[model samples]
Target: MDTECMHINATLAKSGYDIRVFGVGHYCFNLIHATAIFCLLLSLSSAVGVIILLCKSRTGKSFMTWHKHERFLLYRCICDISYGFVHTLDHAHILITKDHVGPSGLCALYALLIVNTCLSEGLFSLTSALNAFLSVYFRKNVNFGNKDWKLLLLLGIGPFLIAVLVCSLGVLGPNGFFCAFDSVKGVIANAVMSTGMTSAILVALFTFYVLTWYRIYTETKKLKTQLSNNGCARSATLKSAKAMCLFVVVYIIQWTPLSIYGTWQLISDVPFGLFLAVVIMTNLSGVFSGTICLFNKSNKISVSNKDLGERTGHERKS
Candidate 1:
């Protein structure tokens, strides 16, 4: 796809089409396609696991008793599956054609799906962090309840609408072996939109997590003051704090590279490593986010089930 686009651009330029090459050459899958295949497998398996785990009802609990974090996981898994499907189809086409040029319309379709995937992932990542923030800030009262739809609208619907608009407006087109905006304005617009959105989400996550940690710190200090030697309680609080820190840390490490890649496109003459970083990081995002959410969700469900069992046992004893 990229090889064809480069030829088209070169031909257009010779014919005075005023196309400035964003960067030289097309996207090479030789080095990264295997990694991408692995990501697809990992994402699909994780998504399946999360879906199965999320559906099980524990005894007599109402549907409303579902955790807000579960909603985030559900959305994340859905997006991962969609994203993985789109990516797999695109790469499969390329591999089958031996990296030959595909139809522009098909390439546009690919671009649209890719944008949707990226935007949805970004929004949901933000939503996940926001969920954690609410969990910390509201403690036992963090239920969105009636406002859950509003949250869904902002995180899911909004991003999808924006992606559709971008696609319809032709802000995305064929790039190389994949689809992206080729024109200078299109490239700039895409860079700004992609980088700006992801960076904003990351910033929000950092801000919320920092505030959450501060709250944890204040509560821990208060506990120490009130109880003087609540050693076990303090230890548990510290562990929770560490867990929160780890969540934020993993989110940053997984997401920052893609944001960097988006921003780097605006500059000329970047190193090959930066391009490699972008491809690898962006492709592996499914693996990272899916695995992390699955791991966390499994642990949360296990804990909930254990608590439920203990309560049932106590009731029986009574």
Candidate 2:
């Protein structure tokens, strides 16, 4: 969506600028972001609360002893906070200042921030799927022997470095309610890099999740054969499967719309309804992740039945 460039004669305007909101009057503009701020705050609060719930669920356990499942949720919490804080601040700034023009370099920085967090979250999710695979097939979370630091570096620092390149085509400018990639360079960059990367991640997610489900099915069958109480075993296992199903459903829904639609947006104007759907879905992911975490600790079952526990984080790689 090519929003009217706030700076008509600015260098960024020549290249084309896109703000966060579009095709709206001042009143509608304020309404959208005012609502955005509220939702982002809700998501932010949920993420923080989930962290507390996680810590509380392990009240008797050692604080330093991070389990596989707990670790994923913790990573998600940090990402949520990073995104929620920055996004909310951007929206709030616009509302307070009633100015669409962002600070000199803030827009590109914000765009970079968006890419980094997204990449990190996708990586973490892939790691979780790998954890599930290992737990179901090999009966363990990944063991790096003594080179655990390598895994840490990949998860912790890799996204930041990668984002520098992924968003390299992006330039700073007012993008509606917030600052982000300018239109000419930004749109093309997003269409290629963002779509390609997102498609790759989605494909990976689909493959791992399918394998995980197959493993669960086989495990359920094994339990039915070994245990006298076959009904109980199947029921327990299905409950675990249900949790994993939640992640699969939400992930596809969350990512699919934008990735597919973004390419079309390169050629024609983005439909307002589609854009709004993307925003609402994108903003609520933090809420979904945090909500899952809060329930996970309480709903977790024994690893003997559920490789993917309610933590769905698969804490029970047990």
Cα RMSDs of all predictions?
6.0, 5.2
Give the number of the best model, judged by TM-score: 2
Model 1 Cα lDDT, one tens digit per residue, 262-309 = 666556444557665666666655466556655664555322211211
Q: Against the true structure, candidate 2 has what lDDT?
A: 0.63
| True-structure lDDT of candidate 1 | 0.57
lDDT of 2 at 137: 59
Give me the runs in candidate 1 sitting further than 4 Å from their true place.
Answer: 1-28, 56-63, 99-101, 134-147, 183-185, 224-250, 293-318
Candidate 2 has what TM-score?
0.77
lDDT of 2 by residue, 1-318 (tens): 334412233454444443233434544565567777888898888888878877887788764355445655666778888888888887787777666545546766776787677777777677666666655656554653333455567666898887777556445345554655555456555555557777787888888888878878876776755644444444454554445444554566778777766766657776656666666667666787776664665676333322333232233332
Query: By how many angstroms RMSD does model 2 differ from the true structure?
Result: 5.2
lDDT of each: 0.57, 0.63
TM-score of each: 0.72, 0.77
